[model samples]
Target: MWRLKTHMLVHTNEFNYSCGYCPYRSRSRSSLQIHERTHTGDRPYQCVQCHATFSSASNLASHRRSHLPPVFSCDVCQRGFKFKQSLL
Candidate 1:
């Protein structure tokens, strides 16, 4: 599968794409495009809950979690957590 081939590039450190502005290289075309945003100052992904913006969708996804209410709570300390694993 293509996913397996992409995962193999991580172990082999073999990337097919190179950045024109820097020494950065990536196995996927999408990753290279995201990296290029760092040089271009292009933050296409914006948070709907806030004014914050990110160059990549993954970064925006991580930021969006901060706006979410905790789904799990610690029984002993009454601490809140967004994920069940975090409560553990």
Candidate 2:
């Protein structure tokens, strides 16, 4: 989901950032670094409340919000969410 849209258009050779695990490769170093997190049990972002960890800061933030009561809910499914964007 994190892979760039441009990656679909560009070839692997053009984007030399290859993954050590599989055939997965990315053009940006940040993309590669984030991808590598899947193989390495490295979770820099940690939730202070539960001590749960996440590879990305955004994911960590999302998990942190889960601990809180829902501020927003989906009109169709009535699913509650803490963030307004989560509803969208």
RMSD (Å) of each candidate, 1 decimal: 2.5, 5.6
Query: What root-mean-square deviation over C-alphas does model 1 reach?
Result: 2.5
Worst 10 residues of 2 by lDDT: 1-10
Best by TM-score: 1
How does each model score on TM-score? 0.75, 0.66
User: Model 1, stretches more than 4 Å misplaced?
Assistant: 11-13, 83-88
Predicted model with the maximum lDDT: 1
Candidate 2: RMSD to truth? 5.6
What is the per-residue lDDT of model 1 for residues 23-49, given as tens digits with 9 covering 90 to 100? Answer: 999888999999999999999999988
Off by over 4 Å in 2: 1-13, 74-80, 83-88
> How high a TM-score does candidate 1 get?
0.75
Residue 60, candidate 1: alpha-carbon lDDT: 93
